[model samples]
Target: MDIWKNIIIDKHFWAFYYYCKRLGDKIWFQKLDDNRANLYLIKNGK
Candidate 1:
């Protein structure tokens, strides 16, 4: 079966989504300010 889905969303949102997918797991995101963000890896469950 094949289905088609059409939706509208922000480009930046998708960009971040793909970025996170690349990261796989263990990620901490911090929004410092508008148009800026920080991504850190959590190690040893810390």
Candidate 2:
């Protein structure tokens, strides 16, 4: 399990999003407020 905090940029967000998607990993986005969010990438079996 890996987590990223404060992913507020579009490019950074999409980069992580696509990387996880291509790897077939589970990705989660949690909005902390109006201008902040967290990104979670969960690898299978780990």
TM-score of 2: 0.38
Candidate 2 lDDT score at position 44: 43
Best by TM-score: 2
Per residue, candidate 2 scores C-alpha lDDT tens digits across 1-46 of 2244444557655666666667775656443446656445445444
Model 1 C-alpha lDDT per residue in residues 1-46, reported as the tens digit of each score: 2211222245654565567667767555442335556443332222
Candidate 2: the clashing residue pairs are none
Best by lDDT: 2
